[model samples]
Target: MPQAVICAYARTPFGKHRGALSGYSATELGAMAVKELLERAGIDPASGVIDQVYMGHVLQTGSGQAPARQAAMNAGLPVTTPCTSVNKVCGSSLKAAMIAATEIRAGVSRMVIAGGMESMSNAPHFVRRARRGEEVSYAALESVLVHDGLKDAYTGEAMGNAGETIAGEHSISREQSDAFAIRSHALANKAWDEGWLDKESFPVGGLERDEGIRPDSSMDSLSGLRTVFSDGGQITAGNSSQVSDGASAVLVASEEAAEEHGLPVLARIIDYATSGVESHRVMSAPIPTVRNLLKRNGMSMDDIDILEHNEAFAAASCAIQMVLGVSEDRPSDIPIPFRNPCTVLVRVRLAISGAPDQLSR
Candidate 1:
């Protein structure tokens, strides 16, 4: 059985909603990341070295057909290269990488490009039944981002409402949530200031750094914000994820292919697992999923040196920490130490092979 390893990784600096990256489409952003990733890996796009390309995209309302193909061709990949677009909502890109790794481990592919892209700034609005010419006097234009991407289709509730439910169930207070949000922003600022994040990032549209970090955020400022989801809700705009646009790409290649091409192995995929919970408890799914993954591999929470859990909402992050028994003393344990500006579907497990070093440049 072949093993899959990440040879290269690159992402565009996250642009705040309608900010620097607003002009670029999701496919264009994906193309930028894919181009840089191939260059970093020293692979020629026309050489047919890559067997496939998989890109995850959520808001595809206005984007043209075959998004992964559009991105690959825009990045100079050969038309012969296969492309797939995946959408598992918040886990879309990670699922893309997981599929690529599965194919490589099964000897179905030698080399693959896997990543995700999103342009919430460009998510379109449409009037329902407009195409069918419904016999209605007025049809309100609905936001695709809010309706298709952020809302729970099963329950017809916004994800923030789910966050509120999770917070209530887990006993996460508003103060705790606000503090976590502050820590996330502070850590992101620190990482950028210390030049740690720049190593894995590249310029896009002349934007050199993430545009969303608020260095001046504090408990006082966060406390004043009103609840968003429900009356007296714990979830607030300050504690929820920012609506940002960005793209990330990574080269997943078989160990044999890496050795042949002399590509540096950044990390190896040991094992991955997926689990689900009740639709309303969407944010809590990671808790059981992570536990199952560790149990299957005969590992424990203590064995994980750095867990990059996505902070979709500060409430969710607090819930996971409380339920998992993650040690607060562990150095750089989770996103609290390395939170990125874009808080959407970006999931990467960095368990280096030998000595655990900073993610290689």
Candidate 2:
């Protein structure tokens, strides 16, 4: 069956944890993006064309229906529309979109909304190693698990530790990682300056600016920072994407539905896949996913016009880039954009809080 087309897409500027959007709940962020997407498509949220609402969330603390339902209701979608919550780690949003597209292809539904939200600033924290609670006296055990107690069930470690392991195993040097991070910042800055992203982002609580771009960046200062996970480990705060708070949404509709509604198509997923690797080697999952995508399309790296891997960690990003035979170095042997990107953004926190605005040098 022909793929569904993306009618509209919108995202809150990924917010640095506790940054400008600390006050807004994830539902609010999702709702804001949903509303903007509908407006972009010239449709009202109450339009019954929407068949389902899928929300991707990793960290959440509250009692109620899934965040997807909350977001849909808050965005003013019809209450009768069905909703589902999906969790695929960072791939959740894309997966949700794919599912909606599949449903459209199967004649299950004509249109749907899919996307994600994560608020690291408000992520629930809990006592360390609740499994060890048995070792503590019975009287003291109950209180220890308080405060939305939850822990990583796999390694009994936090996500940051997993990131650290990815760095060490990949042998991604701190210098190299920091350099890649600077490039991300520079590319993002350029993308903003050139208006490549203007069409994709929405205002949140009146925030119009991207909170992540740094005006000043330098390499010298970045190379001097201390490592975060292990002594002498290559990864550092400068090279990692901050635990961010933000949300994004995209509208998908069948070709017939699009014609009926008079909506424009942005792009369609030609092919997509997801895989699971060892939890400790979580960063490696994308490698297989990309390979499968290429295999299915019978295409190569050179065929792709753009690659948007989540920069979960510098080490993970670099490792995947190299394994895929993608070059980070410029053809001239010098970084394409001239400037030290690390020092410029080490302290700049980006997040969702306002409308999209130009970031000047």
Best by TM-score: 1
lDDT of 1 by residue, 195-250 (tens): 76766788888899888777678999999999998988888878876788988888
lDDT of 2: 0.65
Candidate 2 residues 277-353, lDDT tens each? 88777778888888998988899888754454554566777777778887755211111121111111111111111
**Model 2 spans with C-alpha error above 4 angstroms:** 125-152, 329-361
For each candidate, C-alpha RMSD in Å? 2.6, 7.1
Task: Mark the 10 consecutive residues where model 2 has the least summed lDDT.
Answer: 342-351
Error of 2 at 320 (Å): 0.8
